[model samples]
Target: MRSNRFAVMRGTALATGLLIALAGCGGDSDDKGGDSGGQTLKGVTIEVAAVWTGAEGAGFKKVLDAFSKKTGATTRLTPTGDNTATFLQTKIQGGAPPDVAMLPQQGVIAEFAKKGWIKELGPEVQAAAKQNFSKVWQDFGTADGKMYGLYFKAGNKSLVWYRTKAFQDAGVQPPADWAGFVKTVQTLSDAGSTPLAIAGGDGWTLTDWFENVYASQAGVEKYRQLSKHEIKWTDPSVKQALKTLAEIWSKPNYMAGGAAGANSLLMDKAVTDVFGSEPKAAMLSGADVVSANISETKSKVGTDALTFPFPKTGAKPPLVGAGDAAVMLKDNKGSQEFMKFLATPEAAAAWAKAGGYISPNKALDLSNYPDDVQRASAKAVIDAGDDFLFDMSDLYPAAFGGTKGAGEWKRLQDFLKNPSSVDATAAGLESDATKALKS
Candidate 1:
């Protein structure tokens, strides 16, 4: 049976005066949805922009399809791929922003709002948001006292996935604190197994690792400052966190193929390879979505596999994650209708039923998920509520976060390749942030 074997979850709410006002505005929505004021929305084709591709894209389309069926309106999805900031600027400056953009960050949504390029949620959308989501979930979309985005999909990136039998055989239990975690790593390594499977080659994965550790190690206020470039990366807290990360990185045999081998492993190859039989690694620190991903790579979700929280490495366990948010740019009936639909329990249920989708909306019944494992991950995020932080790198400027070859991704990847270079890495990150956020 799977427990929290290494993961149980619960959450608290973080709300603002504006969101507090929103909280009292409505109640939870029904799973099937409410009236769409259909006459105004019928036959109007709304354009939506998002970064989803492959199965993710396909699953989201089903939700859009459900909206079409409900409101008698057509929806077209425009794939933004990885360049959200540039693509958005190009569209907005050209006077042709999509009716809606499924922004990847609250910070990005705020940026759009600041430039007068997006619309605040209309009354219906705002009311639906209050009815369907938690206050903290709503806060992710709020900036400057206005709600400009509606979170639809989310993931909790704080779990450690392990080869069940390996852990059992090695006499290792999922760890709850840093000391136990290190001991567990040593146990796995001493027992002739690679202790950790790191997705180092994929720069973005490296950033996730840094963010999780930093948030826990350095605290949220510093996390906020570093993310916004309000504080220098060379601060003592940043180095202290790096030292903590170095403990794991410095251990040669703890990871598959030593440091060099781990550095060569790409994100796509990391989990599947690690979870493969005759496994190279006994554990993986990954997001909630990895539950499904491990299965795709032939690892059983709750049997061959199990998970635990990634231990309390600092003041507390911090939930670091990412999500997709719906923001209206056109202010038209179709756009308003679409945003309203996204904030419903029914909209969430549609995607959850389609598989590989998790709604932050508290109104969605856990029964809609694929299985208990999926349910637990969803509940974990819901329970963590207000204490969680968005994926740090994703919450900042492009040059500092999501761009392919630069920013946190590249710098951290470089640091991992040589753990002794933390000082250099910290300096480089600080320099990049200084340049990127110089409005």
Candidate 2:
């Protein structure tokens, strides 16, 4: 299946401007009237805002069209701009918010909940979601004891995507633990191939590696606690996690270029560097990049790609995936109806068919997916229950997690350049995080 290794950990948030536009356009329609047709609701148009455009956006539009036909309610879709978080914030502050917004980041959801800008899904929506989705959706959407959102689809992050033929040629098996994973990297390097392809320019992608290391070393729950400030930055496990990442990057031919030069590579280019040109690279540790890059290159799907669960050091748990939450802005009839529709099995099935990633809902059968990799990914997301950890960036404060936090990326780069300065790097991160929390 196409690995969700990166997508699952990268919680996406809608841009603020797009969200505001949706809210402004749909607010007046919420109060119009009930069903004008026989048993079908009408005169109510729900403004739906999403961060997707192009093919994915078209898929969402298809779902909206289906919903409109089913309820006789007109649906207006506004494509959120590339800057998803900013657009949503502007929309919320402007008092023009979409009735239903799909927020990719949990941090944004939590902030909106705190400000009372978004409405909680009441009894009707809650009942439908519980009936339709797994407990993971409910758990992720709940904040401060209220259900504010629902998980529409999920992505698994702790996976390593590889070229199947390369592994066979090298006579190396996928690693199951930290030691073996390192050995595999060395084996690939010894065979004259880049051991790993990393996209450091997209800072968020690099954050995934940090999260994986933290999760592997400190455990998922502890990592969550650390993000929330329940645990200190100075915690031994956190330090060790950072140290482990540094050590791994230090290995000969571990990364495409040594860690210093790897920072220049972009996510898509990184994938091509490993899979397209260097056929013997063996693997790329990323989320769905294999499939995404291949598709982008117009290469046939599910041909040379394979994925293995990310290896850990101790007490390994099931792989964790990240997903976006479908949030409600106002608890009017229209909003409630829309949310209920999202909870239905039909919505999940439609999402699976769209082919970005698998929906988190276990009820959606993915037998129709043309690609075996995506189908397997769907199964993995369904099977990974409470063990799943949404994107680590989402778990942390927005200041540090968002694009504005270039300092975090700089710290990693600086450390890579001079390993002896690890102490300064840790201290700076802790200080910055403290400032972020306070602000």
Candidate 3:
């Protein structure tokens, strides 16, 4: 079971927004009108809160319904809006927190454990997890020597989504190394296609690139060390990673419209530009972003495009996508049984079928997926071993995460405008990171 300290703190931060939104959504009215007589599953009801909204929320409902049908448990889902961290905090504090919460951000799982709000799932949940999931899933949710959450499904970001036809038209092979990758980009650019579709406007997207490059250049352990502030950003490996990003952004016809204007392109639009028949661009680096975009645009996955792992220097591990885990907050027979259900192969399969993601439970087969790319992505997640986790932004403090969103992306854009600013830019980031850590 994960600890709940972080959830508690996050709840406090999100309390005001949650109250206003809940109040506006007639949540207060529901509280008054609905049976508050403590409805039980069988005779008890379990509340589950998630950040997913719209289609995502609907997809989750399918899985929850399946769980309910099998276990005779009643689940009430509350769409906490876009600010999940805040919404989770609010729900947990009001004495009406969900029994099982789907935490989108994996980095804060440990922090939540440190707080008392979350409870560690004891022997029963662990036994079920051991039977259902791969070792990687178990390792990811284990913190401070205790298991806090059950890994549900994951996506891989170390992928470059490209149009198959576009690559063939340019007469290029998928990049196998950093040099080859750059050459492929140059070839694509020379052929009149934007080499990379960079989305600078959404700051978090930029952070994904940083993590990809960092992991590729220095491997996952070093990347983890960098995140914990154990290694200086001025370290050669760190500088090399940043330089790689700068080079990619600086290339002619590489990033769409150079650095200054690249910020105008959102991730989805950038991806669409690459895969569309008109072929405005050649490739985009992102995780399940392409899948989500294609689903939204009603485009086909394998027919529209495919993805490959980012080329790197060293022995490359499997690329990882973002994933969510179910953390137990209030421990009781009901919560324990619910968590055990979550760690089952049935639950894993249900989640994969509904969400179109790879279940962290290795015992479940992925042959049912329609898209070859998604199946390949699932293989990558399975192969990533214990190194799997989400992007760096979610791993760092909110302030630092925001800085990466706007500050670092902006710095890269500025450097693209003037390559000579590389040293200065790197220095500035290192300084800022140092300060952020100190504070």
Candidate 4:
């Protein structure tokens, strides 16, 4: 069996380093040791591939710099552009794959592991994960009873972003449960504000909405069964979640422009409609990237802009989140050492200090984060402990999870347009999921 080690932690939002930058991993000269923990890792060169770009890429390099110095190693950084899976596959086929790769999806990891293309993490890395991370994260790299990945960096999806001024003006408290959530939207709607900003034009946004609600309402096992196609989409649990979605979606006045204006809003526009001037929508729910959008607006985050966890509506409202998991393709002394470093709080601390990053490693000090928004995102995971689940679309076959027409994207889009036919929507979803997973 092919072995792989997965490591995922939180860092800069939407970091896709489209191009590579050659730079020395920065640090004081004295700390660059020839041997770490009595392991002589002198003069070893490790190759790394990732999609992290912009601030995210820079932050990761800071961590790499630390790893480089600690073990007297150098790294060749390769940016995977938009698709790490495709990039890694091409390299492997050519017998020139990098020593390690930061894979963005569990589905890709599973596929690679099945093809005997990945190497399992070293014992030291696994030990750190057992002690530092929650089980949900530990499982990110594990398949069929063997550990393969480390979920190092995570992004919270359960967060509900809102204009602080709007909530206060309407005398509405951030909701704690699903009932309160619906009621708050009604209150905001009555206050002459768009209660929700939904981006229907972009199909993936619709999938995100459905995943969050479905995971929260249907609970983890059902979510797992559905994600893997073990349970049909037409199951009652899924239907119940769909019906629950309509509770707010069907109420025309509750959405921006009464649902008629959903498609044109787009993701960025949908956010600006809420956080921008004279705000159109009062609330929105999405991953931490929402903060990046908040930064673009004049609203001061944690003040004019704020967030709270998605309301609990199931047996365990595990925080719905997403992250990139680092995995090994080549098992060697150098790559193993780097993986161990990544598993340390000290390593994540470097990225955290760079801002726009969060660490699921409980060993990481929350005070290390630069702002309240990041701390809040990290805290939700800490608060949920081992109860969180990855983004559903990320864990599924692309055919069902992707934005192609007639996939989960279109199904959710259709449901949003005519939410009353949730049964039809659910049936269509099951049919597609079955075909996709089987194929």
Candidate 5:
């Protein structure tokens, strides 16, 4: 969803070395998870809610259809758009919450579980989750020592997608560190190419930018502490990260059509700018799903649109990530059965075959993904094991991080437009974070 994007607020072990050590960790699995134990739902209809729509919504529907075929139950997907947390709350208040809901933000999962609005999964679902997901993922879904959610979709938010020809034309390779990255940007701009395509219109994209930089500059421990709000947003680490971001953002010519132009471009448009017929910029940074957005353009994925990890900003770069977890909101025969099905590799593979998806399930075959680029990306997450950091904004309360024209989204957009306002931005973010997290 544009509003919240990817987040991992759980204080866990996340480091750059994890990604390096796990590069060759992907392998095929024989456990396809096809056994259903003779469970059947002939006349049941299950309702699922999530913020996925468009191609993402369609891909998930295919997965649901697979579930229906395996068990003979009808499945319906309710697209909640960008404001899923608020929408689910309203549904609950009206006594009309869906049978199962895919919570994208962990903060919402905690809030809902604390309010007793969500129910615990049955033993069958729990066992399957333990088998399919890593301990870090399982830990993320657990609150107060009880597992209430199962993460199905996973994201690697550290990639920077760019056009192959653009890099060749600019005579620059993807840089490995922040200093090299800034030099590369300047080279591209000096060669008369817009150096970056930032999706400023979608504020969550800016949050992604900040998260990657913050996690890289601040060590994983500090990143986790700040994510849990143990430290204020005005901490010196936050200022350092903002200044690091300003290296590129503060320069108007380093971006396509300048800051004003970037402020009007959405996620897809930002991708198109670099991969379109007449490319406008050299690179766009975000999650692996940016590959799907490129498919809508003139680029040919692995051949034309290539990706490199976000440049390192510290002693080691952090692997920032995001995902959606399936939680039971209204327990019943259908909901229980569906929740159990979601924990299987079959469920992940079903949507993965439709492309534009990555599964966190360790048992899922890497071949299930549609392309080499995506396969590599998914392997990075699977290999990282427990050493993963989620998107920081996604870990915050929705009022502070998820809302549009308010909270982190608006404040980040303001900072992106005027990178010189670091002091004011940090103060504003701290104020907003305090109110939202406390409320």
Candidate 6:
């Protein structure tokens, strides 16, 4: 399975720019009459659900607005909080699932498909996916040999966003390796600035931190094994990653609010600490979507704020990628049409132009991105191709990956608060993961 995914990535990377020219250009078809097989659905209303709120939500609304104009369909975005899976389950059980949902994890797609809740996409959507997306993306949406979803939004999590002024003040360039990263942190602190802004209040952010470090230090094969539970969390590789993380996380002086405040600081505020007036920190590590959080601040993206790939722990830095897949919960013309639209470059372009968005659609023109920062982030994913790994937590079941105050989320949060017990953290992770994956 891993080899097949990698093969597709390599092919996709090789064909990036060339595919756009060959993908015949008519994504907007406006024939208003019924039975004309046109995109005109004047009275149809499509309800979509996703975990995106704030800037991300507002950006997606632009895409829906574009779709509405092209198809005449009324669209509503029902913002599901961080626990989207739980919210979705409640709606499904109530016999009122949204027409479509943008699920954050591939495991959720498999879970829903196994429960017979998600519908297999029709041929049109499937074909559009084939034409625009790489086989790796298609595989992410497939279950038991059938495609059930389409990945529309992609994020590169191996980025560290830093203030340009902080770098200048500290006389430091972005670090190229783990050792240099550590020195950079200390240097920034000595220069009278907090070195990092950690969104410890949100467990998933910590998970991303662990993933980048683990993937780079342990190598991709071991990373894949651990992700599948083929290797226990107590393995030596896991221990090493935890200790590596502790190098910075264990130091309170390196973070805004000295760890305690960060434990309660949500992502937006953490970002603001770095970019807002009277900046408190020099850097924030997160997915490419962190740009959306940065957008909410007075920071000008390309000039005042910029990103460097996560520093290398091994021979090369790991590019940890993630995405949201659109799945159909109710089979109808309107839902199918919307899903098909999402598969097109035009749809991806709509959101890309709105800023703070990335698409894994190989056929998408990179020129659609608003700035060099956005384009560089998108290119890093495309260029990494077969070498990329999706967010590790998202690859696991919700019990282990998505819940709050329980499972991996809680266990990692505990690890953050007390970096003293690597063994206990590993044992706890393995214990919960074993039980969750088994059932």
The lDDT for every candidate, in the order shown, is 0.74, 0.66, 0.64, 0.74, 0.81, 0.81
lDDT of 3 at 261: 61
Report clash pairs, candidate 1. 4-7, 4-8, 6-308, 10-383, 10-384, 11-383, 11-384, 12-386
Instruction: Report the C-alpha displacement of residue 431, candidate 2, in angstroms.
Output: 2.3
Give the alpha carbon lDDT tens digit for every residue of 1-439 in model 4. Answer: 0001011112234432313353334333345463455324655778888766654566778787777677767776887654467678899999999988887677777778888888888889999999999887888878777777877677777778889988988999998888989999999888877789887766666766777788878878788777777788888988898888889889878878767788555666777788888688898876665665566678777788888877877755547777777889998877787888889998899888776566789999999886888787888877777677777777776556643455787888888889999789999988887776776
Worst 10 residues of 3 by lDDT: 1-10
How well is each residue in 1-439 modelled by candidate 1, as lDDT tens digits? Answer: 0000011110112112322232222212222333655444554778887765444555676787678767666667775646677787899889899999887766677778888988999988888888777888788899899999899888777777888888988998888878789888988888887788887756676777777788888888888888776788999888888888888988878887777877777644566666775577888777776654565567787788888876877878878777878888898878887887888888888878756667899889999987777788889888877876788776676667767678777888788888888789899988887776774
Residue pairs in candidate 6 whose N, alpha carbon or C atoms collide under 3 angstroms: none
Writing each residue's lDDT as its tens digit, candidate 2 over 283-318 gives 666764246455544335577677777788557743
Task: Give each prediction's root-mean-square deviation over alpha carbons.
Answer: 8.7, 5.3, 6.7, 4.6, 8.2, 7.9
What lDDT, from 0 to 1, does candidate 5 have? 0.81
- Which is better, 2 or 5, measured by lDDT? 5
TM-score of each: 0.86, 0.83, 0.81, 0.83, 0.92, 0.91
Q: In terms of TM-score, how similar is model 1 to the real structure?
A: 0.86
**Tens digits of per-residue lDDT for model 6, 1-439:** 0100110111222233423322222223353532335457776778887766556655777777777777877777775656778888999999999999988887888989999899999999999988887777888899989999899988888999999999999999999999999999999999998999998777777888899999999999999899889999999999999999999889988889987876776676777889998788999987777676677679989999999999989877998877889999999998998998898888899989878788998889999999999999998887777677887888888888767777887888888888878999999999999988887
Angstrom error at residue 140, model 3: 2.5
Across residues 64-106, which tens digit of lDDT does each residue of candidate 3 receive? 6655555555667665544455566677688777777876655
- lDDT score, candidate 2: 0.66
Of candidate 2, the 10-residue stretch with the lowest lDDT total is 1-10
Q: Which stretches of candidate 2 lie above 4 Å from their native place?
A: 1-44, 81-83, 257-261, 277-282, 289-293, 298-301, 407-410, 413-421
Worst 10 residues of 1 by lDDT: 1-10
TM-score, candidate number 2: 0.83
lDDT for position 105 in model 2 = 69
Please give the range of 10 consecutive residues that has the lowest summed lDDT in model 4: 1-10
**After superposition, candidate 6 runs with Cα above 4 Å error:** 1-39
So what's the TM-score on candidate 5? 0.92
